[model samples]
Target chain A: MDGTLGEAGEFGLIAELVKIFEGSVDGDEHVLVGPGDDAAVLRIKHGHVVVSTDLMVEGRHFRRDWASASDVGHRAAAQNLSDINAMGGTARHLTIGLAAPADLPVEWALDFARGFAEECKSVGATVVGGDITRADEIVIAVTVIGQCTQSPVLRSGAEAGDVLALVGRQGWAAGGLAVLGRGFRSPRALVEAYRRPEPPYAAGRQAAEAGATSLIDVSDGLLAEARHLAEASGVAIDVRRGAFEIPEPLTAVGAALGADPMQFILGGGDDHALLATFPDVASVPTGWQVVGEVLEGSGVTVDGLAYDGPTGWTHF
Target chain B: MDGTLGEAGEFGLIAELVKIFEGSVDGDEHVLVGPGDDAAVLRIKHGHVVVSTDLMVEGRHFRRDWASASDVGHRAAAQNLSDINAMGGTARHLTIGLAAPADLPVEWALDFARGFAEECKSVGATVVGGDITRADEIVIAVTVIGQCTQSPVLRSGAEAGDVLALVGRQGWAAGGLAVLGRGFRSPRALVEAYRRPEPPYAAGRQAAEAGATSLIDVSDGLLAEARHLAEASGVAIDVRRGAFEIPEPLTAVGAALGADPMQFILGGGDDHALLATFPDVASVPTGWQVVGEVLEGSGVTVDGLAYDGPTGWTHF
Candidate 1:
């Protein structure tokens, strides 16, 4: 059989993909119906179901020349998983919708599905259902469903006196994108971070358990995410710039290319770190630092004032 | 206020779309944390959650000249909802992902959102969360989460002695496509069917309640779907050609074009009717007609013989 999707045909190609997805379904009684069905059925432990969806376009979200098929798959899964975590929920099932040109290798699609399954496994989730079709370019659309034991941490829950905190590496992915764009593959770690980010998934639940008022995943840059929390919570966020000792990778790459690391830190996005607001500074979890304070106002500020650097990224 | 997405900018355009989506959320207490949050939380009425996802690409699933943006949106939602119905579930929430050229008109995007919301509303569902990004062309991806109290109806459950039944129209959309290609718009019903299919959503629950052993939605032609049920159930489906009194709209259009309505009935895809197998002929629901008998063999047949007609569409 030809390794590419076109030679294998749609039905044959789908059979291979479904076999891979089925391996992740571990007889967990929660999955009443799994892959190869019209739709997937899962037992919802809680009364509430948390849902979120994201799309990754070929040229827009990733570059085939730069990222491997697996990398693209893992990135898509990780980002959606992060969204579920930000809601303070334990992720359950992922339904991924994929579209690629008929000529794409069956091996490529298989590897992509494998990567997606691996990422879901990392967060104790599984691929329950999906749709595959042909398109001019590859499109990965992921929808994640989750259940929460505690009340979901909402962006609108932050109060005026709450302390805003940060968890995990912030600007590593943005910096990695810069290095990859410059065609320098020397810094393997930064490039890897850009390809597959390791978000602190458990920290989100920890924040909620510790009485955090609001939570968000830093997917669209730090400043942009802060603005989201502020706008949703009706409180201004004031970040203490000195508190963030820029990660070593961002600093090293920025200095090597004569580029300012602050741009990546403040404006560049795609690093799935946890940014949360807690009612008390003492209650903030370990490995997370107080980066700012929530104030009664409209927008975000840096260093106790409104310092307007680049606010953030726009996909267009 | 430039009308196009590019002139409006990515963030600005998303704000407009979000405003439209927010109108659908409607302060429903079920939506714990709606649109602005990292993920939306919806109260699940049943113990199980059913998920299905579908993608519509610009040139593949639809053509701009053939379908309006609203029609495209409705078509996308209807197709996904049919998958949920096949599982005997009540549609609950939808999370959509849309990508379009930055230069596309904002009003077009808004119209698309409105149509999507309207479709969700038709089935007592709501739009929960979604992502908007820029691409070379318009792409709509929808994930619907539903709840089912009855056991999920799997195509693999049919027995050899079972009877196959179908509900709702077939071949109307396929015939409509043929007519529209030849530029005949007088038959308004066929044209509209092509644009937006009205699947028999409630009939799925009825089938399940009446003890349907196997189920599927005819998104791909009748012969193709019958083959699917046969393969999954390991029983040959001998469809009775005489049983399906070809819908009136397909008959009207097929005559005008001198095309065999049977070809559209057996091979033309995209009608999205519910097809199920019942243990007894008396168990079939009201609007559904018994179309075939489950036989002790493999693959599909027409009146106890082999069918070599078009096996149906392969997306790739």
Candidate 2:
């Protein structure tokens, strides 16, 4: 059973793997229809739904040598959940579509599912339904469904004079990736951050409640996401260089790779950090640190000047 | 612009393609969240949700030389909706994921979207959300969400002495495939059936209302689906040979290929015909022809004899 999955027929493997999650999340009356059906149905009450989708392909997104099947599962779920959190919503349900070679091991697939379930538990969501098919390579496409009891915090509402804030560690994942690629052993914390991101989930809801106007997750790096906010709000974002702080693990990884720590802090992605624009400092949440300010212009500037460095990750 | 899809970038193509369905459906209040989100949310008042997913890969599922992008789109949406109909539900929403080369043209992607929108209109469903990614080859995965006002007619409730009924044409799509593969020119109807299947949608809902105890779509051929029903219900299904009728177009295609029409009727898949088991003849809906009866054992028999033809389509 721990052998390759491609040997087992696609349908048989799915039937067996589905049994593991049976009765996992019982007693949720809101789930009118659960897994085992074509789709799962959830009852939504007086809330706006927030949805996001991401596709991760083998070689393109993850390397089997660097990450285990469980790592892939955790990262997939975390990325989608982080998107929902960025919009000031709590993730509630997820549906996945997986395509893999015919001869992969069943245990690998199950491990992936376990990782997904564990992450869902952390975020208060459930893996409701999924599809599995045989392909030449592996592909994991996850769609997350979330809901907000209040209005969703959009990326277009940032105003001039708003103070910018950040929650959670930044650039640690990127630094870890560099270390892994360079075959250098980084600090344990840095490697862990790259393997499984821990986003500022609760801080998102808190920021929204605290009257944060616009927000986004730092999955595509700080400069890229800040650019998104600025473009969406038709404003400029100015980062105070001295105000930016790098966690020690990131600095250690940068040192190992002989890379500039500032590059990781400004352009490293997959950190899942929350970046928001608030009207005043008093409106910032507890876990959030002031990093910059929103101004009435286009483009992002570091210390009133352009700090040329890597912008972010490009999917292509 | 109706060319290969890899020519345009993913985001630019999506922004253009989504405009095609801009007001296609009138007064669609059930859609709480539509496209542009991670997942689409639908408002279901008094219905059980039915869901199904299908993955179509290039070469394995379709040949670019044989089918246009629009044809692939229509086929993908049609097959998914047909699955919901088999479960006695009305198709409502669909989430699509498309993986293709980065250089694919934008026009082709938009045409594909238009084709999908056309089929969704036929079944009263909408393309709510989807993911786009770059891959070496083309892969189209569709997940359809459906709803039923009554209890879903499952495939496990058939009892002995129940009549077996079918509501749509069989063997047409399979016959078309054979003809296309053999390079034999055929009538337009046969080719069209293979390109875009039109399943008997309303008849499925009617069968459920008429008290269908067990139901399944003939996606894996008549005999194969009958076997599924028998296995799930712990009973035997006997099909009357004389009652299994073939349309003229299918017969012509079979004649051109010098293939037995019975083979197509018994083993052909993708027609998406609804097959149901009812307690009595009176329970069969109009337009549904009685084709067989349920017996005390497991497995399927044709004309009081076991069918030794092809078993049906296997994914791996």
Candidate 3:
């Protein structure tokens, strides 16, 4: 246990770390099965199950210098949970897979677990089980499970006459990343947005209840995700330029960096905002804004014309 | 679609690959929820579930030079399924988290999926869901779910009078590795053993049915895993030297390498063998051989004497 994870050995380290997360989640009747076996089992109970996964790697998705271990844990879990929300589901449980170098401090790993547990608690989910191994660098892979009491909304249900709406902030994370990359100190608001994305979780369930047809999380830029919905639904989506809402911190950071505020708002990723298309002029739910409308044909248009901007982050 | 997985981009690659395994598993009543959402949902009618996870990384657990993409996929699925087998349960489903560079051949990625699906079919399990992401190296993280009609046989239930048994090949994989490492291409049997491990999956359920007190997978060598069971069960285990029904390939390879055959048998890892302790004196089941006995106190002894061979593989 003194040296890196390799020195402590795989089994030894697992035995030691397993003690911390022992008996964390409450055993409910719905939990026909729990941890410490081959695979967990749960009751679906008259609802559809929602599933999504995300992987965060060192130097790729995150850097140890810019984010604490806890920050990484929170962000990783938040992103996957947001995916579940985008599918119109209520978050329930998560299974995490972690790989790190043996030299990583045990405290950091524990802190990472704490961050995950805290986030799960906020969303009424539990860290059900996970796998840990020694690797060259830290990799946090999370798979989240959710439940939908009604029909689960998908990205292929939108029609040409539907209205497009967004639930939550956008572009702040991209602006914050730019500020960090330039080594410029920024306000707490911008930094916080970059570190921990707070997606509109409850709003998703509400939208599903209110009969939203197509939906997806804005992890990539708004235009990119809009295109996904369009292609999947075989309908074109048109955005109103005046309807692009840029948060104040994002605008300030954009100004400081001499970057286009519209680019950040339209092309910036990792916002975890919920975007959906409704069939009629439905009442916009809380934490949501009317952004545009679904149109005939294919592709995405801004103010009736194609607005050429950065599409999104390309993970290659 | 015309390019490799890396070239196709993450979203595009996933969209293409998802089509293959879209309707693979036979819909079971136990699968209260299936794939294509945030998380899969499975029901446990018997009220008992088992869970385990494993991570396979490039250059660590496998090398592309030594293993075809298909072989890697089979090995990954086999290893996780063996964990369920170790718990004396039947594997039901698996969720995969895969990360590979964008430049990887799309055909290779598809082959990996095919291998995984084939293995699941062999064991009456299904690939329920998964996540795909871009990374510098290939990483395969699998989490398996299993179910049992009765209480799971744990590692802490061995009694001093119980008989210790092993149900599978012992040192074939290690001997195969030695042959491969030394560039001795003569031993085809040994090399195949190294590439693909055939664990006694059904024997696990049989052991559970026949009332096994304690059980564990021989993942990190016989002595090392026996030591784990001894520590967990608070009983000492004694391995009889003459009891080993060693295979001919193991002996032949050991003679050629100028290495101790006993070391390969006792200290070798990754054979996916099963070792358990039972109280009854019934005959050994198929695919199993009686190799040792549980004794009073703790630790493991070989041939009624203290063993000091090479300890199992250490992560640190």
* Top candidate when judged by TM-score against the true structure: 1
Q: Mind giving the per-residue lDDT tens digits that candidate 2 earns over A1-316? A: 6566666776677676566444444665656656654346565565765666677788877777777788878888899899889878888777777888777778888888888777877877877677777777788877777777766787778999999999998988888788778876567677678888888878778888999999888987898888888987999999887887767776676676678898988998887999999999988879899999999989999888987889787654
Look at candidate 2 and tell me the lDDT of residue B85.
87
DockQ computed for model 2 against the true two-chain complex using alpha carbons: 0.38
Winner of 1 and 2 under TM-score: 1
User: Per lDDT, what order, best first?
Assistant: 1, 2, 3
Task: Summarize candidate 1's per-residue lDDT along B1-316 as a digit string, tens digits.
Answer: 4588887887787787778778887866677777768898888865578899988888877888888889987898899889989988888888899888888888888888888888888887888889988877777889998888878899899999999999988887888887878977747887899899999989888998999999999998888998899999999888888997877877787788887788887887787988899998999889899899998989888877777777577887
**lDDT for predicted candidate 3 compared with the true structure:** 0.77
CA lDDT of each prediction against the hidden true structure: 0.86, 0.78, 0.77
* Candidate 3 structure quality by residue, lDDT tens digits, A94-121: 7788888878877677777878777777
In terms of lDDT, the poorest run of 10 residues in model 2 chain B is B33-42
Q: What is the C-alpha lDDT profile of model 3 across B170-221, one tens digit per residue? A: 7887887777778775588777777778777897888887788888888778
Error of 2 at A58 (Å): 0.3
- Per-residue error (Å), model 2, residue A303: 3.4
User: Which runs in model 1 stand beyond 4 Å of their true positions?
Assistant: none
**Top candidate when judged by lDDT against the true structure:** 1
Q: In candidate 3, residue B13 scores what lDDT?
A: 69
Best by DockQ: 1
lDDT of 2: 0.78
Better of 2 and 3 by lDDT: 2
